[model samples]
Target chain A: MRVIVRTVSELCITAGTLIVLFVAYVLFWTGVKADNEMHDQIDQLQRQWSASATVHPTTKASATAAAPAKPAAYHYGKPFAIMYIPRFGFTWNKPVLEGTGTDVLKKGLAHYARTAQLGQVGNFAVAGHRRTYGDPFLDFPKLRKGDAIVLTDGTTWFTYRIDKGPYKTVPTDVEVIDPVPRKSGYTRPGRYLTLTTCDPEWGHSHRLIVWAHLDSTQPVETGRPKALRR
Target chain B: MYGWIWRHLPGNAWVRALLSLVLVLAVVYVLFQYVFPWAEPLLPFNDVTVDNQ
Candidate 1:
């Protein structure tokens, strides 16, 4: 009996230690890894942009051009853009990767592949983790009406203005990412954006969504939009 | 349980202690690189997506 008790107790202690380690990984270790991964994604994007710039040598006219050139379809599991929300913080930004798969999100925010491309005339939907993987959207609830959610595709700075949410909804609300999301007050087809993250911080039983409208778009040479000036 | 492994491990007390430390580190590395990532998807906190079907 004594030996059995000792062995069981030792096993319990080991299990406890493992659980603690896992929690630390989830909360801190993952964040550290993800932060570096996101930075690398952004760095790769910047390098690509610079390389293309050297080849094409974008003129001042092209830099100021606001013509809506159709963006090509995004490749899966690739980093293509960077998103910045003034509401998140001045230095808070994340790389936007194509597809919302499990591995893609471990790097940063993942764009819903089925949704519209960035700043397009449709619902440009995106998703990010709320609590883990650096908590890209940890302060998602802090987003209010009129907040700015800006993004760049290495070409244009797309500024979107939040119209509604931090709206709490269940995971089944797939319509939230629709071209004209139901209850998002968007009755017509237009340039809209949707942001979704898990609710209650540490739980995934629910989702929190925010809807925003494309306010403006300008070439990257314009040197940051007014919304991002702050 | 640990006593058995300790007794079986070849080396003096100091060397045995170093080996135990290495063992712990190996376990941690495996857990972080493979085990945790495999198990992470099974956990609920990672379900940050919405599916339409």
Candidate 2:
């Protein structure tokens, strides 16, 4: 009987250790790995943007000439833009990768492939992690109605105003990303941005959304915009 | 099962300890690389929608 008790105790210890390790992997190790990958992605994007800038001088005429061309065709899992939320922090910026695939989200925020292109006349929807994998949108609930959600596609800075939400809804609400989202107060089609992250900090049962309208745009060579000045 | 593994390990106490550690690590690697990813889709993490329609 004593031997059996000892064996059972050992088994319990092993099981407990395994559970602890799994929890650490999910909550901590994943974030470290994701943070490293995000840094690499941002560095690569900066390099590409600088190379492009050198190719075309930073004149307004050149910027206008370069503007009409739609963002490069979507390449799945590629980082294409950098998103900055002034409400988050002055140094807070995340690379926006294409595709919402699990692998892509592990690296940084992902753009919904089916949504409109960046700065276009439709909703440019994006999603990011809320709790694990660096928790890029951990402070999502703090976004106010006028917070600036700035995005740059290497050539122009598109500053959007929080016109509607920080709305709470279930995971199944897709209408939030419509060209004219139903509850966003906009009637006609226009340039819009929608950001989504899992709600409740650690739970994925619901989603938190914020909708914004494009307020202004400027060429990258013109220096930091007023929204990012501070 | 524990007794069987112990008998077949064929090593001194320290060697057996190292081998057991390696076995545990291999299990962790497999679970993270294969099992968790396969199970991820069934989880509620990535189910957000753009519209109900």
Clashes within 3 Å, all models in order: 0, 6
Residue A29 local lDDT, model 1: 90
Task: Give TM per candidate.
Answer: 0.96, 0.87
Output the lDDT of residue A140, model 1.
91
Q: Estimate, for each residue in B1-53, the C-alpha lDDT of model 2 and write its tens digit.
A: 46668778968988988898898889988877777656555555554434321
| Candidate 1 off by > 4 Å | A59-67
Q: What docking grade does candidate 1 earn?
A: medium
Residue A39's lDDT in candidate 1: 97
Q: Per-residue CA lDDT of candidate 1, range A1-230, in tens?
A: 98899899999999999999999988899899999999999999999988987886664345433345677789988998899998889999999999998889999898999999887788999999998788999899899999999998887888899999989888988989999998899899999999998888888789999999998888887789999895
Q: What is the C-alpha RMSD of each candidate to the true structure, in Å?
A: 1.6, 2.8
lDDT of 2 at A109: 93
Model 1: pairs clashing at backbone N, Cα or C within 3 Å: none
Question: Chain A structural similarity (TM-score) per candidate?
Answer: 0.96, 0.95
Q: After superposition, how far is residue A11 of candidate 2 from its true place, in Å?
A: 3.2
- Going through the candidates in order, their DockQ values are 0.64, 0.32
- The per-prediction i-RMS, to one decimal, reads 2.0, 3.5
